[model samples]
Target: MGLFSIKILLVLIIGYFLGSLNTSIIVGSIYGTDIRKHGSGNAGMTNTLRTLGKTAAILVIFGDILKGVLSYIIGNIIITAIPDSSTLYISGIGGMVGGIAAIAGHNWPVYFGFKGGKGILTSFSVVMMMDWKLGLILLAVFVVIVAITRFVSLGSILACAAFPIGAAIKGNGTVFILFSAILSILAIARHNGNIKRLLNGTESKIGEKKRA
Candidate 1:
């Protein structure tokens, strides 16, 4: 393989390994529980909170966010090393080879019996790589929705929707727009159960007092 190809592979490896570090699994092991076995039974931040309380959940959120950032950084470095990179503006998408690798890794972490949390953290990082401003705006939407609705799923869904608007505002290329759309789809698909629960009113709202 060419040198550039080699470099790209390295980036993907970094991203995948980093992404494979599932926050929920790590925390769950610490507590002698599989996060997926208790509470709402999801492995992402929301479920982590329901299972382990605020401190553990907050740590999971940060850990997940960091993994995303790491994946983006790995991919960006790869694209930048090569000339005439189409992924320059939103090059992170191409590197999403790495990003998705990471998310996939999280979903089925090698270290955690091939099961992991939802891709919420990866989505957060991927969106940010599209554009930090866009990512921040997306984060704002999630924050607002989650803060008011107490539904992390709603915030996540809304955040995914914000990608296109942010790309348009920045006048980014069609590739970024397409990338955003795909992410929106992935985000929604991952939340299918959460959406159903939300509709059925069985989904947990953030900060709600747990019943005995």
Candidate 2:
């Protein structure tokens, strides 16, 4: 039991370290831009896209989301090794879970003075572990909403809301429900600028990208 517990803690520390690698900052630095100094002052995919180009944006998004997924897998594998939920190696499903840590890493990367993106991609990656089916549904919602409204913030916010919507519909336990609520709040916090622009009706559309 003690060994199993030690392993889980090891997973947590390793997962956090893995999550701390901030790709946005590296990409931005490569381009001679702080990225945070650019669009929305955020080190995120949107800012990368707006500042660099499509390729850079895609890479950043993929990398950020991948880190989340990979770290979750790391923790998940450790938990699985214990072969029972009663084991001390099991991790919770709350905000401090594998998914949330990834988001934390993105929003406040230890490698970069705790300055990072809002963790939207990392949040989405969380669903990948919870249930790819739900993730796909939320993803579809994200695409449709983003396509119709052309407002990235609106799409993300709505999709996040879908978490609770799906949970309530499926009669899920409180873990996912509580996670949805907190994820929504984090998403909102990350999009404070977009929120302002949205209030003013000046937020950019997908293709009509603007400089921050």
Candidate 3:
């Protein structure tokens, strides 16, 4: 394989493996149970907070965010280490590609029977790494939505929708805008059940206690 191709492959693999780490599940195991078996049955920070409490949830938040940041950094390192990589916007592209792979792995982790979190936190981290300005825009949108509605799902969905728009507004390249759109789609898709519940007015709001 060409050097560029090899670098891309390595970045993709690293991102996937890092995402597959599944912080919630790992934290759950430490607490003596499978987090997926309780609460929302979703292995993620929100569910972890509901099922395992604050400490576990905090750990998951850090771990998942770290996965995205590390993936981007590592991918960029790989791209920059090779000659002629800068000719194709390879640094940015590689980082975004790794970020995408990380989100994909989080959603359908190979180690977790292809069932996992909805990828919100990881997406936030990746977006931050890609462009802090865009990330801030999404974060503001998310915080406002969640504060007003108390619906984390709504915040996440709306924030995801804002990604591509924010990227475009920032005058990012077409490729980056396209990648942002893909990430947005992937996140919204993962929230399919939440969307249904939202429509039915039965979706759980943030801080709502999990039933026994």
lDDT of candidate 3 over 152-208, digit per residue (tens): 989999999999998898899899899899999999999998898899888888888
lDDT of 2 by residue, 1-212 (tens): 56556655666676667667777888888788898877667788877887798888888888888888887777767666656545323244422366666776778788999988877788888776777788899999999999899888788877887787786787666766676667667776878778788889888887665744
Q: Order of candidates by lDDT, top first?
A: 3, 1, 2
Provide the global lDDT of candidate 3 against the true structure: 0.89
Query: lDDT for each of the candidates?
Result: 0.75, 0.75, 0.89
C-alpha lDDT of candidate 1 relative to the true structure: 0.75
Pull out the clashing pairs in model 3: none
Q: Judged by TM-score relative to the true structure, which candidate is superior, 1 or 3?
A: 3
In candidate 1, what residue range of length 10 has the lowest lDDT sum?
Answer: 85-94
By lDDT, is 2 or 3 better? 3
Q: How accurate is candidate 2 locally (lDDT)?
A: 0.75
lDDT (10s digit) by residue, model 1, range 100-202: 6677777767777776777877887877766778788888888999889988789988788777767877888787777677667766777787788788888
lDDT of 3 at 44: 88
TM-score of candidate 2 on Cα atoms, chains taken together: 0.85
Q: TM-scores of all models?
A: 0.83, 0.85, 0.95
Clashes of 3: 0
- TM-score-based ranking: 3, 2, 1
Give me the runs in candidate 1 sitting further than 4 Å from their true place.
1-6, 82-96, 209-212
Q: What is the lDDT of residue 57 in candidate 1?
A: 83
